[model samples]
Target chain A: MTATAPQALATLPLADDALILSHRLGEWAGHAPVLEEEMALANIALDLLGQARALYAGLAEVLGGEDEIAFLREERAFRNCQLVEQPNGDFAHTMVRQLFFSAYQQPLYARLSPVLPLAAKAASETAYHRDHAEQWTLRLGDGTEESHARTQRAADALWRYTGELFQPVEGLDVAWQELAEEWHADIRDVFGRAGLTVPEGPSEGAWSAGAGRQGLHTEPFGRLLAEMQHLHRSHPGATW
Target chain B: MVTGSAPAGRHPREASLTQLAGSVPDPELPVITLAELGVLRRVAEPEPGHVRVELTPTYTGCPAIEAMAADIERVLREEGGAERVEVRTVLSPPWSSDDISEEGRRKLAEHGVAPPRAGARRAGPVLVGLSPTRHTHPAQAPAPEPVRCPNCGSAATELLSRFSSTACKALRRCTDCREPFDHFKEV
Candidate 1:
């Protein structure tokens, strides 16, 4: 089996999701609003990176190498959801995004755990991620007027991008409709408590924004790739 | 869980190798050995002079894993006189705080860190768990035991943050003792 194998190709989307979101979270290293939050986000990023590493390691037999697959892939080759690749607009925006993704990941991993060892292992970590995101979402959405507005705006802005998460990828045999409904119910439950509105956009119907799983991404994904791949590209064999 | 156990008593060579590998102190918490932490899953001499060890991580992204692997290799090569050492990490049946030995729990409490509650985690797939404050279905799951204050042995502890100095720990404050400490929370 090589990189061209269908099984290997199926792996790209899952690995890319963790890796890209991890990079986005790492961008907050020294820039987080407070020390506690800084630690929290970094911890989450580390967890996701660990997952990405494990998934990539499994692919090492099928793919040439983890580094080659991750570092050398062009923009169109990545298969993460567009939602994860979106830039961190604000703290509220980041939290909203985290909430959306973690909510999806928890159930997805739980359902996949029976078949994939990696997925089983990641389910535990995903629980904490969802908790972290939900906590922040509640505080931000129900706080001061500005925070309320910001959180709500972030939710509405990221809503369209979330449909891609439930869209079926070729290799994964998941109950897509069930997963989507669960995700929706989760969002509504959390948003209701936080005093936030569920965005009116069509989440699963045609015209909702998505397609990162198909190697089609939004504009910012290219820049994200440049920054992420720059060091690995420049120092091909550099080791810490 | 048993990979290669025969009908006879354990092999003496394999036992010693397990001890040697398990003796390595955890990279983050020096108070506990890998064996005490229960992350040192297994060690076997599969072939002459070839040592293979399976180590699990408390958290998937625990940075200490690489360090732990390196340390295990160093010990097996220099101390155990192994010509080749290969440390492999295993993730199935993912490491849980319940994996920590009783000795490990005592050490953590003595050092003012609360040990995870035994059996707080059930086997099989499930969420890692959330604070009781914001859980979606509070009535469905039994209430978790209160985290005792390590300093005063009081149950009057409250969560300050779900995350703390390390990923495995949660920041907690003891209302009784007015002391903030880390709870080695259950996974």
Candidate 2:
């Protein structure tokens, strides 16, 4: 709680991204294959929640209240990109989603670190996150026949949603092109080694796909929001 | 009670308060004091008897931060005789694993936990080895040298898991001694 730094409307999307992804990862609590894996996902989720809280704390002045911004807002009000809100389809699906998001987020944070304190603080954490995702992708894609097929399928299904990440937000000064290039190159390198190929669909989220940045999310996002907001909505002003 | 006799009038008090606050044991790694861990950023008597403590978290989501803050406040009030104690969290100059002092590192090793290697972390995306990555470590901090086991100082160690009992630690096992220990991850 450093004196609430005057926040930008731009911080909203970034915060929402972290918060939503955290909830999605949290859904793996008891269901992850092993105990250590369960811990890893939960730890990563905690890190995302921390990043979201830091961003939201900055926005408390403009956004009214932190809990309300998270729990009370409608689906249209949220600005997280479509990729994060997509449900954790399977183990491979979860890893690929993490890979795409963390790859984008790490470099973006590196670029933003100079002007934004949160970004600088989180850059290293995001790097670790990318590492985690990359490792999982490499293993799942190169492992057994079933593992490779499942991993490839997950990558193809999720490829379209990734385009929304590059869409620039207001007030944040960043080289969106450079960030996207870095992400694409890195993802290609990882995928190439993992025996996977880039899907042929339009990577540019045009008008029909991956429009969560404009508050137009996929079908799964609404259900996610419902589950996420239920507790706070059920008991207003609830204290943990 | 012994004032002015010290090197500086205010320094002795601040130093004493700093040591007092730093003496609070870390909730997770009780082997090291907060001072040794290097997280107690400041201890200032803003007004007479009213102490303000500035602390930072090792990791943003570290759950131990609350316990650390509470311990700091309690020790300062009960021992330092401060009328009002306020422990505030500051995130500006975020805490780093490098902040853990030499003595703290020593204590961690003594307690069978590997201390985080300073300056081992590089600044950039890690190039993890391709297909069937053996080690599976995020190449971010490829310890310049192998993480020496605290129990036996064996260079042949394996990383078991990235996240361990706590967020800041990673589990590793020593090849020689066959003892599994927690290596403090360099952030």
Point to the candidate with the largest TM-score.
1
TM-score of chain A of 2: 0.95
CAPRI band for model 1:
medium
Candidate 2 runs further than 4 Å off: A1-7, B1-10, B121-142
State the fnat of model 2.
0.33
Worst 10 residues of 1 chain B by lDDT: B132-141
DockQ of 2: 0.39
TM-score of 1: 0.92
Chain A, candidate 1, TM-score of 0.95
lDDT of 2 by residue, B1-187 (tens): 1111233655677778877888898999899888788788888887878999988888777788889988988898899988899988777666778788888999999999998877634533222322221243435444455678999998787777777787788777787898889988777
lDDT per residue as tens, model 2, A183-203: 999999999988888777776
Cα displacement (Å) at residue B16, model 1: 0.8
Candidate 1 lDDT, tens digit per residue, B67-176?
99999999999989899999988998788787888888999999999998877567332223334232223222344666789999998777766678888887777888
lDDT tens digits, residue span A129-199, model 1: 89778878888888889999999999999999988898887877778889999999999999999999999
C-alpha RMSD for every candidate: 4.0, 4.0
* Candidate 1 Cα errors over 4 Å, as ranges: A1-6, A204-206, B1-8, B123-143
Output the worst ten-in-a-row residue range by lDDT, candidate 2 chain A: A1-10
